[model samples]
Target: MKQCWLDIRAAEGLKSVLCQEAIHRGFDAIVADDPADLAGLPPTVSRVLLPGKELPDAFGDADLVIVDPVQHGEPGRLAARHPGVRFGAHVDVTDADSLAVACASVTRDPVTVLRFADPTNIPLEIVLAAAADAHGLIVTTVERAADAPVFLGVLEHGPDGVMLAPSAPGEAGRLKDAVERRSPDLELTELTVTAITHAGMGERACVDTCTYLARDEGILVGSRAKALVLCVSETHPLPYMPTRPFRVNAGAIMSYTLADGEHTRYLSELRAGGTVLAVGADGRSRPVVVGRVKIETRPLLSIDAVAEGGEAVNVIVQDDWHVRILGPGGAVLNSTALQPGDRILGYLPRRERHVGYPIDELCYEQ
Candidate 1:
C-alpha cells in the first residue's frame, strides 16, 4: 500500500489538524522532531521521529526513524549500527548529486523521505526521476495541498506517498482527496483480430474526460464483457485540424467500457459527472471525470477479435481516421486502416459482473 506522511516539526500548532486529517484519510504516518508534539495523535497513525545522530531513548518507541545523511555518516552504516531499525534517509532536493546518491543508497531501505528545501524552485521532473530510481517507499514533502496532486498524478503510478508539512494548515483533507483519486497502473492483454467489417452508419459516442490526456492515453471499450480493446483518444495530431487532447472518440453508444474494475458499463451510460479510467499504452491508468459525451451519426466499422481462451468479442467504432485501437507492440491502428488479420491489444476480464460489480453468475454481452 502507498504511504503518506505529515511533517509537523515547523508548524507545531497544526499538528492536531494534520494528524486528524491524516487519520481520516488513512495516511500512513506522521513525522515530528519532538515526541511531545506527537501527543493526542490517533494510534492508527505510525509515529515517526526525525532524530539526529544520537538516537534518543524515546527513539525505541518510534514506528519509523528518518536520519539525515549529512548529520549521520551513511544510511547503510546507521542501519548496521542499529540492527532491526526501520530507518529512512532524508535528503535535500537542492543538492542534485547528493539527492541522487541518497536515492540510490536507500533503494534497499524500507522508506526514503525527500525534502524540498526550496519548495518554490523544486523541479517536478527531478523528483519523478528520483522516484523512478528509488526502489523503496518514496515519501515526498509537499509545502501546500496543491503540490500533493502534482506529485501523485505525474506518472501512471506516482510516488508511493507524500509528506504534508504544517506550512499549509487545514489543507490535509484536500491533499488526501487528490492522492486517493489518483489511479494506479493497469494491465493490458493482447487479443488476435478475427475480422473487420463495415457496420454502416450509426451513432457513436465520443467521450471527453476532464483530465488532460497525453498522446498514448485512451480508454478500453468493446462489444463483449470478456474482451475489450483500447480506444485511443483524439490527442494524435492530424493534417486537417488541431488535436483534441482531452477527448477519446471512443466507439458506438452500446459498446461496453471497462471503466469499473471487474465490471463494465455501456458507452451510452457515461455522463458528465461519471468517472472513467484513461489508460496509456503502457497499461497504466488514471481516473478522469467525464466532462462531456458527444454522440453523432457517422460511418461505422465493426471489429471482431478472439482472446487466448477462444472467447470472441467485437466493438463498433466510427470509420474515421482519428479513431484508433492499440495494436501489438503498442502500435496505433487507425480505424480506417484496420485489416482482418491485425493483432491488437485488449483486456480479457477473468470474471463476470452484474450492475457494475463482479459476481459469480454467468453473464453475456453481444
Candidate 2:
C-alpha cells in the first residue's frame, strides 16, 4: 500500500478538524509548516514539520523535519544537532540541475520531499527510477487529492508516498482511499451445467474494453446476481474473423456483470467510460474501462448451472458457437455446445444485490 501524508499548511481555521480526520483515517503523517501545529498530535501519526527557508532555533514535538539543505544545514548535521527529531531533504525540481539534485537527495536522504514544477510526471519518473534501489522514502507533493492516483502509478512502482495539501475538509480521507485502492482476487468455483434451453430472440451485449484482455481473462455474467458464469474474452482464434483481443461477448443486456468486487451492473446499463471487472481463469480480477457495449437482437440461449453448494445460476447469451464460457483449468467451452453434466467456471456471491450494491436480504431471481 502507498503512504498518504496530509499537508495542513494552508488549512487556516480547519486545521484541527483536518488533523483529527487524518488521524482517524489512519493517515501515515500530518505535515504542517509551524512547529506548534505539530504539537498535541497523537503519536499514531508522524508529525512532519516543513518550515520556511530560515530554520527555527527550537524543535518541538515534530517527528520529522523537512528542510532545504541549501537554506538550512545538511540533513545529517541537522540530525546530529537535533538528535530527537528526524531530518528529511526537500527539493523543488525546475530544471535539469534541480532534477539531478532531487535524484541525488532520493538516494542520500532518509526521506525526500519533492515538488515538481512541470505538470508532466517526467521529473518524478526520473527520481523514482534513480531511487529504484534506494532504501529511503520518496514523497511527492501533489496539487490536489485527486492527482494522487496518477503519481502513485508512475513507473508502476510509483513513489513511496504522496503528500497532498487538501483544499477542504474530508479531502484527507479521499486521498487515503485513493492511495489504498486495490483489486482483490476472487475464489472461482466449478459449477455443473444442469440444463440448457433456447430462450428465443433477445438483445445480448458485447463488452468492448479499452485494454487488451488475455486469453484466460474475461467477465462474469448471469441472469441472477447471486451467481455468475465466467464468459471468456474474444482473444481466441475465430475461423471467419480476426481476433478481438479487447472484446468479451458477455451476455444478455439485462444480465448482471460485476462493476467491482462489491457491486454489479446490468449489461444494458454499461456505457462507454464505465468500468467492469476483467477476471482471469485463476480468479484474479482487475477493472477495465468499457469502450462500448454492443447490443443486438439475436437468438438467445439460457444456461442453467448449479454450484457446489447446490445454488442455481442462469446466464442467457446469444445462441451461437462463437460465444463461449470458461471451464476448469482454463478450458474454453462454446456456449452452443454446452450439455448437461458439463462443468464450467463460475462465482457465487454471498449476498443479493439492490441497485448494484450488495445487500444482506432475501431476494429471488429465476
Candidate 3:
C-alpha cells in the first residue's frame, strides 16, 4: 500500500479538524512546519516536522524530522546529536544536479521527500530506478491529493509514499482512498446454461478500452445487476475482420457490467475515461478505462444460466458467432454455438444495486 502523509502546515485555521480527520482516515503520517503542531498528536500517526531553512534546536513531539542536507548539517551528525527523533532528507529537483542529489538521497536516507520542479515525472522515475535496490521509503510531494494516484503509479512501482497539502479536511480521506484503490480477486462460479433464445434487433455495446486485454480477460455483463457473465474481448481470431485486442462486444445498453468490486453500471452509462472491471477466466480482475463505446443495432441473443446455489443469471448479447463468451479454463465459446447444458464463467454479486451503487434491499429482476 502507498503511504499517505497529510501536510497540515498551511491549514492553520483548520489544523485541529484536519488532524482529527487524518487520524480517523488512518493517514500514515501528519507533516507540520512547526514542532508545536505535533505536540498533541497521538502515536497512531507518525508526527513529522518539516521545518523551514533554519533547523530547530528542539523537535518537541515529532517522531521524524525532514530537512534539506544543504541547509542543515549532515543527517548522520544530526541523528547522533538528537538520537530520539528519526532524520529524513528533503530534496527539490530542478536540474540535473539536483536530480542526482535526489537519487543519492533516496538510496541512503531512511525517508526521502522529493519535490520535482516541473510537471513531468521523468525525474521521479529516474530516482525510483536509482533506488531499485535500496531499502528506503521515497515520498513524493504532490500538488494536490487528486494527483497522488498518477505519481503512485509511475514506472509501475511508484513512490513508496505520497505527501500532499490538502485544501480541506475531506481531502486527506480522498487521498487515502485513492492510494488504496485495488481490484479484488473474485470467486467466480460455474454457471450452467439453461436456455438460449434469439431476441429482436437492439442496440449492442462494444466497449473499447485503453488497455490491450489479455486472451483470458474481458468484461462482465448481464441483464440483472446481481449476476454477470464473462464476455470475451476481441483478441481471438475473426473470420473476416482483424482482431481489436482492446474491445469487447459487451451486450445491450440496459445490461449491467461491473465498474469495480462494489459497483455496477449500465452499458449506456459508460463513456470515455470511465472505468470497467476486466476479469480473467481464472477469476482475477483489474479496472480498465473505457476509451469509447460503440453502440449499433444488431440481432440480440439472450442466455439464461444457473449456478449450483440456485441463482439464475441472464445475459443478452449480439447474436453472432464472432461475438464470444468465456468458458472454463478460458475456452472461447461462440455465442451462436452455445446450447443448453454449456458451462460458462460468471460472477454472482451478493447485494442488489441502487443507481450503480450496491445496497442491501428487497429487489427482483425478471
Using Cα atoms with residue i matched to residue i, what is each candidate's TM-score against the true structure? 0.58, 0.90, 0.91
- Between candidates 1 and 3, the one scoring higher on TM-score is 3
Per-residue lDDT over 256-347 for candidate 3, one digit per residue giving the tens place of the 0 to 100 score: 99988888999999999999999999999999999999999999999999999999999999999999999999999999899999999999
Clashes of 1: 0
* Per-residue accuracy of model 2 over 1-366 as CA lDDT, tens digit each: 788898998999989999999999999999998999999999999999999977888778888999997778668889998767799999989999989888888888899999999899999889998998899999999888789989988997789899988888888888888888888899999999999999999899999999999999999999999899999999999999998999999999999999988899999999899999999999999999999999999999999999989899999999999999999999999999999999999998879899999998888787
lDDT of 2 at 328: 97
Worst 10 residues of 2 by lDDT: 68-77
* Local accuracy by lDDT, each model: 0.76, 0.92, 0.92
By descending TM-score, how would the candidates be arranged?
Answer: 3, 2, 1
Q: Which stretches of candidate 3 lie over 4 Å from their true place?
A: 80-85, 238-241, 360-363
Local distance difference test, candidate 3:
0.92
